[model samples]
Target: MSRRHLAMLTATVLAAASLTACGSGDEPGDGGKTLTYWASNQGASLEADKEILQPELDKFEQQTGIKVNVEVVPWSDLLNRLLAAATTGQGPDVVNIGNTWSASLQATGALVEFDDATLDKVGGKDRFVPAALAAAGAPDKPPAAVPLYSLAYALYYNKQSFADAGITAPPTTWEEMAEAGRKLTGDGKWGLAVEGANPSENAHHAFTFAQQYGGEWFDAAGKPTFDTPQNVAAVKRYVDLMAVDKIVNPSNAEYAQNQSVSDFANGKAAMLLWQAAGANLKSQNMAADAYGVAPVPFLANPPAGGKQVNSMVAGINIAVFKHTKNLDGALEFVKFMTSDTEQVTLNKTYGSLPAVGTVAADPAFAADEQKVLAQTLATTAAPLPQVPEESTFETLVGTAIKELFADAASGRPVTEDSVREKLTRAQQQMR
Candidate 1:
């Protein structure tokens, strides 16, 4: 299963009381010393998350003398629960947010923006991975959150399947990938597993493919560029895997990201586009030697200066609700969570990359997949556009791809004109 790299929620209004409540250290019913934290579930289950995090919380409390209340919220509920709390001027002192939502949430004025002085308290901005920190918020403003954990997408292929098909190496260009896919498809199996039903997963792929084809999602002024000719071509190319190239299974239109990963792990498909799928694949009893990792394939005929790119720097970020009464303690906890010790411990257990650069030296991250992701992060990967409407972009663009997938699956014509129509509607809607 794909890890919950980001869980975008609809932005909501913060209560009137929240404006003054934040950073004030003044609330009526509770003492300011106790800090409340809403942690995203990081382990197999909510209970498992609690077990993993409580010991760390205990250590923090012992050192700081601040009582900490912890709640493990499932991904489905975390956003709405935060909305409810913000509406009531009552929420956790610190909480986890999808890094991509930082800009959207920042627009609501609900999260604390870390300034130079406050950032200094957390060991300065130099401690974090540059690409990871860049995803926290916009370039011109203080970031609404700081990266907590990180991830990048990679190509995961079935080694035995490749050997059986007589392919000695993973394809480096899109043309070679298509050729390899054609050769790998047969005997009741597919060459590639695609996640058509999962909108976010589709959106992530759109970003990578569009970028590879020299298509930008937003113009210089940050206006929607959804229907551009280049983007249309990119979307068509992706859909062609099923509709034209016939390398992917048409039935895969029903697959979500998890189902796609399952297909690859179970030998129903030869290749998968995924991030940090190791732990989940292991859970499904897949052997380590069965699969191999490679950089995501790029375009064979990229425009001048264009190079292969993979994913937006994806991960969760930790933010403080600006309205928390225990201002000092909340800030302290933020520092503690992003500290070197905790970053290593949490990311190690979660099967994710650490936000802090120094922590990457740990042996736990020395796997081949981790190395490829690390190289990509340092070289070609980028964050989602740091615009206030990034979440909307994800929703609108993802839905467009979903519509295309539906057409291909149902035997409807997926013409360039139809692609433009869907994309234009999504673009105009964004206006």
Candidate 2:
């Protein structure tokens, strides 16, 4: 999942953090028999992730005689924590990172570069899915990490709610979606649920909308272009769901903690735009059959430069830190986790697509939801810009949109001018 970004870490802070580094002394003193790991919270909760991973970790220990000390990190703190560890060289031997942040983290030069030799130590570079591996780092460079789980966003709608509202089928275009959403709204139920307060979630949608509107957040030279007319229109179009279309609940302005998913599962909302939401819904006691998945809608009339993109290529990556003393053990662990058997096991449990190609034909991934995600990933989803400043772009633009959502919820007008002004401020901050 995409995570909240704390303020950008200044170079001064990084230098200061580096001054206290003790040169690989953070490794366990047990002769590399033990390794520290920081895992992103992938399950319903941090504890839930530990429960799911402990057995797999134990299996690795049995096979390799190396014990992993794992700590599940929440999305809210993961980025900042990672930055501290990256600068100080004093944390996990291995870590899980949001795939979009791969390039940004790589800029610190704290991650082990997966060159041909290093990749050979694990599995060959060909083991991962091409699209997934493409997002692991900047283009034309050795990946800073390897793909672990793959995801693409889809529109999930309550089947019963659609039927009750007399809607015949899922929307194929933005206009149809808004019309459907209007019909779905009434009787204390909203047409759509959104994680408006969440910066990362907001950024993901912004990227997709900007794509459909023929907008580019970054120019050809990889500079911020956040306040262009196309982008302003795109941002306005999204906030209008609450501000103008009135299909989303105003209370969604405060939903940053997956509360939008809960609202959808509980029938308080009819639709959700999310990445691999099935596992999360099931955890909320929602049955598999309760919802139908469809491709996220596109513009009915796209502009001249519009792209067919619908979702951002979303997933997690596993990276080994340069400071790791147990390089052999860490590579072994990576190989074990990405092995075909483990890929199927973990992806099935998380409702995510396997990052490796060998598991594509597995029966465990043949579900309807999986099919939709697979199709999207194979066809239309684009990765967020894999530039060194991508994470900072996510933070600045996402927080700006979050503030716009807050305004919309507070009964303030969300106009094109207001949207442009907010985006301009975000662009200025990037400079």
Q: Considering every candidate listed, which one attains the maximal TM-score?
A: 2
Clashing pairs in 1: 22-322
C-alpha lDDT score of every prediction, in listed order: 0.79, 0.88
- 244-267 in candidate 1: lDDT tens per residue? 877888888877546777788789
RMSD of each: 5.2, 3.3
Candidate 1 whole-model C-alpha lDDT, 0 to 1: 0.79
Model 2: per-residue lDDT, tens digit, 1-431?
Answer: 11222235444345555433222235547666887788997777888889999999999999988888888988776776787777666778889999999998898888999999998887899999989999999999999999999999999999999999899899989889999999999999999999888888888899999999999899878888999998999889899989999999999998876789999999999999998999989999999999999999999999999999999999999999998887888889999989998999999999999999988999999999999999999899999999887888887888899999999999999999999999999988777
Q: Where is the poorest 10-residue window by lDDT in model 2?
A: 1-10
Name the best candidate (by lDDT): 2
Those runs of model 2 whose alpha carbons end farther than 4 Å from true positions after fitting are: 1-7, 10-29
